[model samples]
Target: MKLQQRLIRLSVGVLLLGLILHVALLLGYEQLTYRDRALQDLRGRAQILALNSAAALAFNDTRAATENLQTLRTAPAVVLGCLYAEEATLLAHYSPSGARCPKRPQPAQGAGSIRHVESVMVQDQSVGQLLLEERLPTLAERLPRYGLLLLSVIAAEAVLILVLVVALRRRVLIPVHDLAELAARVTERRDYSQRVSTHGSDEIAALGMAVNRMLCAIEEREAAIKENAHLLQALIDHAPAAITMKTMDGRYLLANQQFAEQLGVSTEAVIGLQDIDLFPTPIAQARDQADRAAAQAEGSLRVEEQLGERVWLSERFPLRNAASEIYAVSAIATDITEQRATQASLAQALANLTQLNETLEARVAQRTFELKQAMDQLVQSEKLAALGSLVAGIAHELNTPVGMVVTTSSTMSERARELKAMVEGGSISRSKLTEFLEDLGAGMSLIENNSLRAGRLINDFKQVAVDQTSMRRRQFDLGALIDDTLHALVPLFKHSGQRIESSIGPQIACDSYPGAIEQIVTNLIQNALLHGLAGRKDGLIELGAHVSHGTVQLTLRDDGKGIETQYLPHIFDPFFTTQLGAGGSGLGLYICHNLARGILGGKIEASNHPLGGATFVLTFPAVAPQRASDAS
Candidate 1:
């Protein structure tokens, strides 16, 4: 039963019990009082009759005695009985007609020759004994009146109890029950606006107030969350990058409009489809490999993949659950096929420019031999025009490494000085120096133990800046070249409390100018650390290099402030900087862009890091060295 019903029943039961006990006690008291009163009246009348009878007998007046007896008999309250001593002499008796008294009634208090009796005596002799008995009124005369009175009192009490029950139900149970129903409705419909009525300052009213307050809080939080979700959806819908999410087992969970458009499919078709399901042969393999790598590393992985005639710059990252397990993967791809074509065209242009330089140099030498004075002015003009374009492109390519070298070399010089001072102060003993020498002697290390990194930085820069200033090709491990570039730049990152982490795949051989590859990697790492972590104090820079199909792809990323969507498309432009004035030379990425395109026979692009930062990806084709016969 409900609480209200239980309470009401208990209350009624208690009231009924009290009323029944009270009625029973009252009836018992009334019955006992009536019986005592009747007995006393009978005793008083018997005493008067006995005294009068004794006086008449003592006077020897039979007539007076008989008259007195008749008079007593006529009295409304008296019944007379007569007796004779020893059953010999006659005596008088009186009783109501048809009222039978017991033939022998023994009385112990007094007797007229009986064992116990109330008697009248003459000259010390007992004439007869008087026996009186009291009779109570009948049920027909009194029981109906008493029963009516009892029933009236009970009816009044019952009416009072019912009134109180009705009042309680209205003032307490009704309001409480209404509030419970309102709560149920609110839960069913997920509507928080319905409120309970508060009629008084009782506990129920307080409960209503608490519920209203809770609903208000819930509504406010829900509104804020919904607003955030709307804003995020708007961002995803309009983002320039193609964004999508897929299950860990390779089923697509969601694909934004941009991704759908890039894949030339509808969003409905793209969702729930795996890479192999949605994409054709080669591109699907690249995507699957990237997804596996991302899941394995539990981090982001980027790969350059070709779909039909288009090139996509794709990044895959593991989406983790609360338990730190990879639950899904999110991918963002940018179409860079046009960018790659532009880069190839630019490389061809640079090669033609180089051929023109060599031809002009040879022509100048020949003309000088033929007529030194006549062709001087003409040679100079040709040199200037050819030099101008070379200067612009090469300058763009050199700026990144030059800037990084300057930064890293300076820090290395400082560290060297600090080491020198420590040694001079006896912090490094002669025994420690001997141990270091022994360790170094154990390997044929080309770079010096003390200044190897700084020296390599200088050497790498010189190959691009001076020694191999012309477009020259060589066969080398592209993965190793990237690794060496990151190693050289470690000091600069160390100065900023950051580390360079690399995942270079096994000996990826490529025929390309190492200077260009070095410059591209240097620029990417520098940009990731400098701009990606603009305000960060400590961070990590990840460099990954691998050979797939006929190309070597390198990805550099960092944990820092991610790029804004508006600025992502324009990062590779000549002079675009999100950090307008705070020491941001837009030429950094611009240089990296041109080098990857012009000198390295590759393509470069920038994007927002999925794990929150910036990422630069470079893809270079593997080629064989040009033989002397082929050059001719």
Candidate 2:
């Protein structure tokens, strides 16, 4: 039993013992008083009978004496009565109804006359001695009835004691039992909300009050613990790095939102699941090893891992329970894909700078001799510069068609592989071969269509390249250029479940390189769709272009996960990419920036949108109207 039950039992036992003792003492006193009063009544009756007998003897009338003797014989407590002369002769005798009195001893001369006897008594008289016997006949008749009455009183007292015991049990024992059960439940469940109720100002009530206060304190502490847990969970969920908690056995116990998203799975699906369940082969083994290292070391462990095309910096820390036992391992991963790329790029730049320094040093030795033939050298330099510009223009023009060809070839190869699988699986039966052939013919037609599309892009690239190399200006609709760029990138966005909503106002003619503007818009839209939507399923890309004042402004925005505030400053750096080896060239944005400023004569700025996403703003100067005379 718990302390509460023990206390109640002790208190109840003491109370019952005290009550029994009190009742016994009271009953004993009552019985003693009743016995004393009965004895006194018997003595007084005997004395009165003796006095009446003396009066009868003093009259000396036979008939009156006989009547008095009869009256004494008929007395309730008198068993026998008689009248006699001084010599102690029996004048008249009477016995109590249905009872015999014991024979009394004769009184000696010196012996005291029988003043009081348990049997008979005689009174001194002139004619004869008046005798009276004290009989217990009346007492005998009342004895059985008194015994029955005493038994009834005892039975009533027993019933009252029983009722009191039951009341005490109900009021005290039952509540104490309930409180004990509640306490047991609190211990087992670790839930401290339960409390006992006290009804009145009794000791049990005071005990209940004390218990309730203790429970309140425990509950308050439990609430504080829960609040702390919630705060910690919130912090983990909002953390920028991918965080996960795994058991020592390599089962995931908890994962933050970013971790689940990075793994391309739901948090619920990842919990209690081992790495092998989500990933294949070496990745699972690597994760298991890391978890074991953390547990064995009883400290933090860090390792760099390459999963697919991205590199991750993973740190694991041993999570210990209250008993200092290793319960789990907490792993935090930072996608260091971009950082690794930056390091590689820095190394390449150093090599290039070294090469450039070597070239400069080689040319420095010939500077004094070249000064005499400076004019001829200048002429040769201009020719070489023009040739270099021409080669750059050709390379730029060829880039569009090469990109188109590569995209088409990859799509065709994937389709061919699918068709081969269908054939091998018998999904396409011999009977359906003719239909398959027809489909193949249609696919060839599609290839031709795409080929022409690539040619058109090539033509546009050539025109823009020629214009850039010749330093020629032309009038072109900015809205039309944006529309063309959107059309070209529509297939890329379509596969990713993204829709572009464009709000192109009335055509604003601009005197600039139209191809450069198209390239800039294409790079911006592709970046928004890929990086912005990263791991998201559904997203929207909006492109708004219009004439603001004399400048044409174009805004491209996407409703995807926005970039972190810390990374905003480094976004425009050359060869920087959030996506490193996952088909990111890093030159897309760099080329776009250069084209916007150098060719389109525009300024571009990027910022996080208020609604939650990334936005790029581009402004181009309006084209000036030229007369036919001025053109001539």
Candidate 3:
């Protein structure tokens, strides 16, 4: 409801609440008053009857006492009348014609009725006692008349409350409402001249006066705001760094002198021009995208792009209004090409190569270090991809047996239900029972066998996956690692429509890093698939290992195209790829070479097999030579 209605309701509700409380108090007093009156009437009647009945009691005339009690018939409230002789002997009893009276009347009858017992007196000598009872009015009998009176009083009070409400609305509410309207108008027009009448010392009038003062303050702020605009323009022109602003669509809104100098344009020519009009095609496109990203960003964004021949680093942020809506994007850019030459900030910020500001010797050192780190990351990525591929293959292998167990379990449950129904219905036969038991046995056997297969595949894959990913060095059975690696390669073979076999047994053991060996083996298999078995389904890979003295030499040969004579020497060099840009990273063999030497303390040689395709033989100790890191 509106304030007008709310105030009026409050006025009327207060009056009604007061009237209800007053009526409740009045009714409570009236109840006690009526009860007291009943008791007084009963007492007075009892005293009169006692004096009249004393004669009959002293004369021993019960008939005379009965005649005297008959006087109570005139009082309709009386329900019982009794007379007792001085010796506590009943002399007479009286009630209404059809009403019954108890022989022993209680002295106290509580709230419903008033019972009075009086002793008869004859010349200061007591003769007998008289008992009288009168009924008190119930709430039902009393409310009708009381409620009628309350309604009349409530009607009067409602009329008075409405008059008061109307007066309050004009004096207090009207001024408050006028102040609100004035505030709204001043806000809409931003005009300080508008004011509400403040002709009283009331709170509402004071509020109107405060609003007028606020308008004056706002007018003063407008002058300050205009002054600040000029200050901002001067700051922008004198700014140390180049500053520019553009809309989300790339139309320039502002540009400082430094910005114009870099663009080789005047300040006037720079405004209203898009990035494409100022920079080269590629540079303009990149900066334009950066502008759009800044406008859409929640806060500041960093952009690096080359302008002309110098690289510039820009910090761009959005200009938002009161509603947090982006109206434009602003950027402050600094030429960082020279900066990168003197400092390592670019390397720190981007975690990338930094050789711009270095001396020739230092530049070469930094570049070489960065290349090494990049190579390591690339090799790690390749290793992870291989591991992931193996995981996918092992997961595929587990799905088959797990799926079989699920299907077989469901079938067994249904068969058991059918067998239960047969027995329950007394229709089970010897043949059917035997067949059911045999089928259950077969299902249990199938479930158990497949469960074990899934478990074994998981356990085997876990060892390989953990070893490859963690890169932790430990002792492992060379034969078992080779078996697991080859088993994991089965999926790769199936996918490529090739075959791989291993002749090594579990007798030969290696204490070297199996993880390194696994990667080398995987890379060789994949290399064979890419080059030797690219399109041939009959491709075969033969893996053989043997121990000599204290060294274990493993050989992997594939029945595919052999390496070309010219590229054979460079095959294991970093970034050496005969199939460049043909889905080959060129770092696989390089990674294998690094792991063999640096990690395993061994060497790997790549050559074309004389009898068939390509061959890779990796030779390392049964127990690996101490690594430089471990030795240090």
**Which candidate number has the best lDDT?**
3
What is the C-alpha local distance difference test score of each model? Answer: 0.58, 0.59, 0.68
TM, every model? 0.34, 0.32, 0.28
> Tens-digit lDDT track for model 2 on 172-277?
7776666667655655675667777778766567557756765675577557867988999889988977899888778888999888887788878899898998
Candidate 3, residues 1-632: lDDT per residue as tens digits?
34335454554444454566567665776676777777876876676466446547756787877887787776777888988874566888878855555565457867678788877765466766788888777977866535533433444566655765576778776875776577446545656677678875755565466556645644565567668887997898888779998876788999998898876778889889998888778878888788888877788998877776786778999998535678889999877665445234312422211121123235334433543454344446755564543443344445545555666666656666675565444344558767766665665566565555555444444444322322446788888998876654443354456888889888897777776687678778878888877879888899998998988899999988888899988988666776777856566787677667766767899888888799999988899876533432
Given candidate 1, what's the lDDT at residue 242? 87
Ranking by lDDT: 3, 2, 1
Model 1, 1-632: lDDT tens per residue? Answer: 44445455545544454556467665666566655555555554454445445544444446645554564443444443443333323344456653544455444322111122356543346655555543345535555435533443344466655765676687667876776687557546767667777766665565567556655754565577679888887788788878889887789888888888866788888877888887776867777778888888746787777767776677788988635778888888877655554444434534544454455446434432433332243335643443333334343443343344334334333444443454433244446445434332321122232133333333333233211233447778766777666655544554477777888865888887776576566667666665777677778788787788988777888888878888888888766776657756576676677667656657887787666877778887877334332243
Residue 164, candidate 2: how far off, in angstroms? 3.3
Distance from true location, Cα of 284 in model 3, Å: 83
Which candidate, 2 or 3, would have the higher TM-score against the true structure?
2
Off by over 4 Å in 3: 1-470, 628-632
Query: Which candidate has the top score in TM-score?
Result: 1
- State the displacement of the C-alpha of residue 99, model 2, in Å, after optimal TM-score superposition: 77
Question: Which scores better on TM-score, 1 or 2?
Answer: 1
